[model samples]
Target: MDLIHRRSNSSSTGRSNTYDQLRSSPYADVIYDTTSGGEYLMKLQIGTPPVEFEALIDTGSSVIWTQCLPCLNCYDQRNPIFDPSKSSTYQDLRCNNKADHSCVYDLVYGDQSYSIGSFATETVTIKSTSGQSYVMPETIIGCSHNSSMLGRSFSGMVGLNLGRSSLVSQMGKHMQGAISYCFSPEGTSKIHFGSNAIVSGEGTVSTTMFMKKENHVFYYLNLDRLDAVSVEETRIETLGTPFHAVDGNIIIDSGTTFTYLPASYYSLVREAVEKVVTAERVTYQDDDSLCYKTDTMDIFPVITMHFSGGADLVLGKNNTYMDYGEGAICLIIICGPAAPNFGEAIFGNIAQNNFLVGYDLSSRLVSFKPTDCGVTQDIPIDDNSISAASLFQFNIKFVLFVFVLSLIRL
Candidate 1:
């Protein structure tokens, strides 16, 4: 199998420094700011009676888990915690189970947040665009206990990575290995699977996805250049050097709110942006964001990201700039700590709004189609080739659950 490997330094914790908590605080009541596009959640049903949960759709990490009953130190969530005892189809996985590996798993997040729980498999269900419900039994899941801060609006999280146990991979065979999501910064979004996941036709552009064999959880893309240029063809240089040949230099993260660039690249981009904006730039001592006093964004120049495979993404003034409120506007791009080997550039969800992003695992390619996601019509699912028997047949009484150790405590 072709896998996309994730490279992490052998730091004492084996996690990235970007998530290190600079301030000391209690983990239970941590609140994350969402004004900058923090996360997106989707609805799903699991187990016998089919309990519904609003799960955070995360592409950066692999591990599908939810807070369950008998919670020991779980966070206060908007939705009721899932109770396994109520689900007739729920079953626990034992360490000695033959068909299954170990029933226990430990997880730790980049933020030093952790969860411990049991890993089990159960029936998973999702609604189609037609409002019809589809069920896949014997699906892998984690019923977390002693969980900490998670997105307050989220009941749990759905893993959409390349790992074998991820929701995408678990549904790949039946869904033709297709998945797509269209995010709206102001509201919620829908996640499509199976035949409904295809994003083709006009306004669609394709790009090659780089995958390594070792770690396949993160999506890597080749970013050629990020530049701001005048219509006159005059090259405007950013902070650092012009450009470097960096292959698979960045990861597209839907879970994160802000886009992060290396310090040098960020300085260059910010300088170029400041030159054209007529609004007065100001900095807030309480926050590190660079803000301006203006309601008009059209006066700003267009920023274009040239990607591999000749796909150029042109950012609109509105997409690149955001309203910081109180008559203040701020640039969404942030300067991240530099990483050796260009290991830290992240294209976050803020920059991906109003676009239909699709991942075709079979073809090993990712596609971006420009559309007004807030009003885009749901694509019809074509399940003609799937046998009817397979749709309703329940495989071996599958059951598992785990406490997620690494989750976004929003």
Candidate 2:
């Protein structure tokens, strides 16, 4: 399973708005690649005949969706729009009366991108590198007839969060509530589910994971302290005026490009790094990133993040900073909006590079292990691991009833 990164093609104005929206909302559903700060895409097949397409893998959203045919208004995509009418296994889940029974969904992103479509069920298939195929039937999906402001690289999104409609939750007991992924700086990466997702070996550390009552679409972790090696150790609670150690203080998101801290705390981190590095300070007018005129990241100090349960993640220059232009490197961590408006911090994917990160939802734990993601061993799968009879049985009528009922309640 190789993940594809999409580069940014938007103008400077659009890029600025994307950054501002991400900083203000912790739950933005934008897909990020390394260049454009978007997300990783996975190849999958939808419908009975199997229409293969690449979809954005997001941890901040729920509901699997793709642009469908007869598009009222849609953005250009690399692949052709999916035609539900041509699929033999597609089911509309129409009500008895059939006059106005279509289940419609309107999903809006923080950057004002949106998808509007009807809810339906179809067969989904995922093929592993070893040529083993995992077929899931009656998978709920949104057939987006109207959409806007989406990139052309990927056709749709695959939600991997803790929400009920997420792919992980819909898989039920088969996946055992587990998932793992390894991200490389460049080239392809891998993501696994079920038993193959377990992370265990030397240098592996586990930490507690929290799920908010109001928001279950994000993975939360607590940051106890941070130490700029050979510089200074600052407790998170003591850095900001009224900051305190709370469970799930920071969210670990794979769709975001940079790590974000509160404005007050980020100022302290900036000052500490300025004193340690000898590189000439440069202003990055594009965004609120700290840039330095240096040829190499060797001048930057190693940053250690001490999380709850004694999980100390040691980040090198590659994980802490990135190349901005010809002769300048900028810190990947930036200052987010001020407190009250945006209080939660973000642990973006840049810091997770070169590490195998595993999440065990049943155990409520997340594990991290340092590994060269670019050249990692592949997990072998048994040909008979999953059978057609073992697939979860779901009632389409019942699902439509509940979905329509929820809309009525709202």
Candidate 3:
């Protein structure tokens, strides 16, 4: 997932208020909240001072990058610099693309304010309340020169979400088995770093949207009000495109800002949205995301994507449209920032806000359900650490299969 939606990084406007529910959970300790909120406060060490500010929890962005003191392009910062010099365990792995790193990535957001120096290998630690600390390895991070966007004045981002170079994937190498986590927005959000032991919870989570094909990533789609809107919304008014894509895989990233679609499909969607929204209202257009204006009446009728099993997902007015400004919204929308083959679509935090995504590292599964809040929770599936059986109907299906097979054989 590339840049989902960027507003050409202007110098600065009015400072916005940031809110984050950051807490520790037994399953995943680093479940930090990166909502529209600016930043959060956390003690680097048990005795260390707690620093908080705005941070973009990007599902699209894999690396957890942050601004430092020496950055020339650094933007409005409110907190003290993270003095890497002070920490005894601090060491810049210095593994850049120049060295034995995978891909040399030097990216600048559309704003061109913050330029990131991509590098692999870094040391990460948590300042535990009991004065104890644990370190995780194989995590990649970003060094930012500048930071100025919706949120402001922040040290850096705490990214352990899913993506190609995410800390989860990198740490998985050393951790051995898997990493299970749930982000509790109610001051209970914590990262369950390094182990599946922490992901235990009561209740069985279910869904057919989870796939363990490649590295097991979470994926879900709800077209707002597919049920109500489909009455006159689209030809195929449904939820997810039935039968999972055998062609291209999908990833549910919390860091990304917007969604991406194939060129042809995007065009069709634009046309569908255009049918309801006139051209005059939704005129602004660009590369990353489609910009549109909405009138009082055009509050988002409906946008449905027909899926298998005849199950139609009905996205409400909110999920159906994007908010651009006051009394107006994006009519026909398309969010594809740095998307590959135009096929790789990203369901960024804004969209993910609608669902509670549970990631089971040990089982290699991601489950999603209707959630009003942005914080993804562990759906009370069964008394199991990982929501495996709940995500995939495999366990239930297998039991029935065995029973029927036994009956037939008998």
lDDT of each: 0.65, 0.71, 0.43
Best by TM-score: 2
**TM-score, each model?**
0.75, 0.78, 0.56
Q: State the lDDT of candidate 3 residue by residue for 1-410, as single tens digits.
A: 23211121222522221100011112323333444352222322211232233344443345666665466566655556555445444445554545554343455543343445444344554532212243444345665554554455445654554566664555444443233333334443433433322333333233234444544433433232243124244663223533125322345555544545545445556666667655355344443444455544454456543333343444445554665565346632354345532346554444433444555545554444454443543423223223333545776888999999999999
What candidate 1 gets wrong by more than 4 Å, as runs, is 1-38, 96-102, 111-113, 129-132, 187-189, 225-246, 338-343, 381-410
Candidate 3 Cα misplacement greater than 4 A, ranges: 1-55, 94-105, 108-123, 126-152, 158-165, 173-245, 274-299, 304-313, 335-343, 361-364, 374-410
Using lDDT as the measure, the top candidate is: 2
Give me the runs in candidate 2 sitting further than 4 Å from their true place.
Answer: 1-38, 93-99, 128-132, 149-152, 225-243, 338-343, 381-410
* C-alpha lDDT (0 to 100) for residue 347 of candidate 2: 84
Lowest summed lDDT across 10 adjacent residues in model 1 is found at 21-30
lDDT minimum window of 10 residues, candidate 3: 16-25
Cα lDDT of model 2 by residue, 1-410, tens digit: 32221112245324443332222211111223543344677677899799987777767678888989989998888788899999999997565554688788898865567899988999887754223356668988989999985454578888888887787787676567787888776667667777667788999988889988866678988776433122235333433433335566678876665688777777777777777888788877766677888888888877777777888888868888888777889987777673211456778788888888988988888899999877745554444334333333335666888999999999
Is candidate 1 or 3 superior in TM-score?
Answer: 1
**Could you tell me how far off, in angstroms, the CA of residue 33 lies in candidate 3 after the best superposition?**
9.5
